[model samples]
Structures are given as structure tokens and as C-alpha cells.
Target: MITQKAKYALRALTALADADADEPVMISDIAAQQKIPKKFLEQILLDLKHHGIVVSRRGKQGGYLLLKPAHTITFGEILRIVDGPIAPLPCLSITAYRRCDDCDGEQNCQIRHVFAKVADATRKVLFSTTIADAAQPTHSAEVTRLLA
Candidate 1:
């Protein structure tokens, strides 16, 4: 499951991607536009910066911007930053792979097999999606908010 933190991270990144590349956007602006809580967003932004996905400027007009182009920032990267492993079972995870404590056999674990497929499907969507993709008109807040 995607945590609230991951969702907020994606939301903030999408807002930043919508801005002009030459301009740095204020954190307050992103929070207001995304309706994200300021305190929570600060931490989320900090994590993004630490992961090299975002860079921050400290001054009167300083705020944040993507370290790379929006198209280079994948949803998988954002989710991994905020949500940890993509796979429900650690055994199915690529980076964090470890056998579940209760599971004894790798070849006979039905639950693990099911989750492997789930993880693959999830990875397919998230890895393929980029911050630029999230900024598309079809994904605009006016449309998303209405659907919500």
C-alpha cells in the first residue's frame, strides 16, 4: 500500500514539474496548490532532497526544484523513497529481498507467488510513470479533484 507520505511526495513533485524549469518554486506555493499540510511537506521535501530528486535554495526567494528533469524522475523512485519496498513480501522484493519468517519453501509458497505478480504489476505502472507524466492535463487537479 502507498503511504500518505508517498502520495504527498508525488503530489508535490507533480506540482513542481508543472512549473517552468527556469523558475524555482516556493515550498509554500506547492503546499497551497496541492493542499498538503506544510509541516508534512517540509519533511517530504527534505527526503526528496536527500535522495537527489530535489534541490533546495536557502534565501528570500529560495525554495525547491527538481535536481533532474521531470521526465527523469520516476514514480518508482518517489515511492521507494517514501514507502520502502514495493513488494508486500520481502522475498519478492528485488532490493530488499528476504524470505518471510513463516515461509519455509521458496518453490511452494503460493502467497509469495501471488505477491510477486502484484509487485511486478505495480512496478510496471510506477516505473513507467514520471513526474512529467503526472503533470499532464488528464491528471490535473480540476479533473482529479472532481473524481475524488
Candidate 2:
């Protein structure tokens, strides 16, 4: 399951994507527009900023913006930043791979095979799906509806 932090991070990133990429967006404005709690959004955005997923500006006109193009920033990357690994099981994670402690023989384990397939499919979709793809007008309704 996706955490609230990841969801908010994605929402805020989508808002940033919709805005002029060069122009920073006010945190308060993003929180209000995206219906995310300001305090929580602050922490999430800060995490993103630290991860180089987003950049922050300081001053009267300061705000946040994506450091990279939205299309280049995948949901997998964002989720990893906010939610840690993309795979449900550590053994199935490509970036955060770890052997299942319960399994002495993963090569022969049916459950491990199943989780590996699940992880692969999940990663394929997530890695292909970028913030820009999630921000598209065509998909915006579905995404927003899901979030709501």
C-alpha cells in the first residue's frame, strides 16, 4: 500500500509539473490546491528536495519546482524516496534487493517466484510511469479520483 507521505509527494509534484517548470510554486498554494495538509506536505517536499527530486527557492517569491523534467522522474523513484522500496518483499526489490530471511532456497521457492513476478510487473508499470505521465490531463481524473 502507498503511504500518505508518498501520495502527498506525488500530488505536490504533479502540481509542480502543471506549473511553469522554471517558476517556483508556493508551498501554501500547492497544499491548498492539492488538498494536502501544509505541515505534512512541508516534510514530504523537504525530503524530495533532499533527494534531488525537487528544488526549493528562498525569498518572497520562493517556492518549489522539479529539478528534472517530469517525464524523467518516475513514480518508482518518487516512491523510493518517500516509501522506500518499490517491491513488497525485500527479496523482490531490484534497487533494495535482499534475500528473504525465511527462505533458505529462493531458487526453488514458489512463493519467491510469485513475488519476483509481481515485483517485476509492478516495477515495469511504475518505472514507465513518470510524474508527467501522472500529470497528464487525460489521466488526471483517474489519478485525482484514486487519491480522493
Candidate 3:
């Protein structure tokens, strides 16, 4: 299940991605548009900025903008940033791995073996589908594009 924070992060990113890349969007604007709490969004955006996912500017017309292109930012990357490892189990994690206390041998663990395949498939799909894809316009344009 996706956490509310991670959902906010994805929605916020999609909102920003849908806007002009050259301009930054204010947190309040994003919050109102995405129906997210302003305070919660502030913290999330700050974390994203720290991770180089987004950048902020200050002055009269200041706000946040993507540090990289939407197409370059994957769902997996955002999820990993806001949440943690994509693996279902800690033992199956590549980036945040730790030996499962119940397991005698990692390679010999049947549970691990099954989940490893599931994790791999999930990771592949998440990593390939970018924020740009998620932010794609809906309605007739989306329908035509899908048909094409």
C-alpha cells in the first residue's frame, strides 16, 4: 500500500511536471491544486530539494521547480526518496539490505526467492514509468495518443 506522504510526493511532482519547466510553482498553489496540505507539502518539497529532485528559488516570485526533466524522474526514484527501499522484504532489498533473522541462508530461503522475483518485476515497471508518463494529459488527447 502507498503511504499518504508518498502519494503527495507523486501528485506534487506530477503537478509541477505539468507546468512550465522554466517557472517555479508555489507550495500554496500546488497544495490548492493537488488538494494536499500546505504544511505537509512544504516538508516534502524541502526533502525533495535536499535530494536534488527539485530546486527552489527565493525573491518576489519564488517557488520550486524540478531539478531534472520529468521524463528523467521515475516513479521508483520518487517512491524510494519519499518512502524507502522498493523491496517488499528487507532481505530482498538491494539498496537497504539486511539479513533476515529467520533465514538460515539467504540464497536457500524459499520465501526470499519468491519475493525477489516479485520485487524485480515491480522495480522494473516503476523505474521505467516516469513522472512525465504519470502527468500525461487525459481526455481526448490522451485517448488519441494511446491509440497512436
Candidate 4:
């Protein structure tokens, strides 16, 4: 299950991606338009900034903007940024692998094999899909349907 924080990050990111390229957008504006709480969004944006997904400027005219183009930012990157490992099982994880306590030998484990397949398919879709794609009308519909 995707966490509420991850969902909020995606929403904030897509909102930033939808703005004019390289244009700074205020946190208040993003929070107001995206319906994310201001404090929560501030933290999310800060996390994104640390990940180099976004850059921020401070001052009267300062705000936030994407560090890279939306088309260059994959959903997988953002997901990992907020949620960590994408694997359904730690044994199947590439970044944070750990043996399952109940498992015997992973090599012949039926459950691990099955969940590995699930993780692979999910990873492919997420890693290949860009934020620009998520922000598109048709893609947004598909995402909503899938999440629903």
C-alpha cells in the first residue's frame, strides 16, 4: 500500500511539474491549489529538495521549482524517496534486501518467487513512468483508475 505521505509527495510534484518550466511556485500556492497541508507540504518539498528532485529559493520572490524536467523524473525515484524499498518482500528487494523470517531457502521458495514477479512488474511500470506522464490527462485517468 502506498502511504499517504507518498501520495502527498506525488501530488505536490505533479503540481510543480504542471507549472511553467523553471518557474518558482510558492509553498502556500502549492498547498492551496493541491489541497496539501502547508506544514506537511513544506516537509515533503524539503525532502524532494534534498533528493535533488527540486530546488528552492528563499525570500520575497523565492519559492520552489523542479531541478530537472518533469519528463526526466520517474515515479520510482519519488516513490523510493518517500517510501524506501519498492519490493513486496525484503528478500526480493535490490536496495534493502533482508531474508524473510519464515522462509527457508529463498532460491526455491514459492512465495518469494511469486512476490518477486509482482515486484518486478510493479517496478517496471513505476520506473518507466515519468512525472510528466503522471500529470497528463490520460495518464492521470489511468493512475486514478488503478489506484481506485
Candidate 4 lDDT over residue span 49-116, tens digit each: 99899999888888999998988998888999999999999898889999999888998899888998
lDDT by residue (tens digit), candidate 3, 1-148: 6689999999999999998988989999999999999999999999999999999989778999999898899889999999999998899888999888787998788988999998988887778778888788643354344334
lDDT of 2 by residue, 107-135 (tens): 89888888778888778777777899788
> What is the per-residue lDDT of model 1 for residues 1-148, given as tens digits with 9 covering 90 to 100?
7899999999999988888776788988999999999999999999899999999988887889889898898889888889887888888888798888898898999887887888887787778777887797765564345324
Q: Estimate each model's TM-score.
A: 0.90, 0.89, 0.90, 0.91
Error (Å) of candidate 3 at residue 61 is 1.4
Rate residue 128 of model 2 by lDDT. 72
lDDT of 2: 0.87
Off by over 4 Å in 3: 138-148
Summing lDDT over every window of 10 consecutive residues in candidate 1, give the lowest-scoring window: 139-148
lDDT of each model, Cα atoms only?
0.85, 0.87, 0.88, 0.89
Task: Say which candidate scores most in TM-score.
Answer: 4
> Against the hidden true structure, what lDDT does model 3 obtain?
0.88
Alpha-carbon RMSD, each predicted model: 3.7, 3.2, 3.6, 2.1
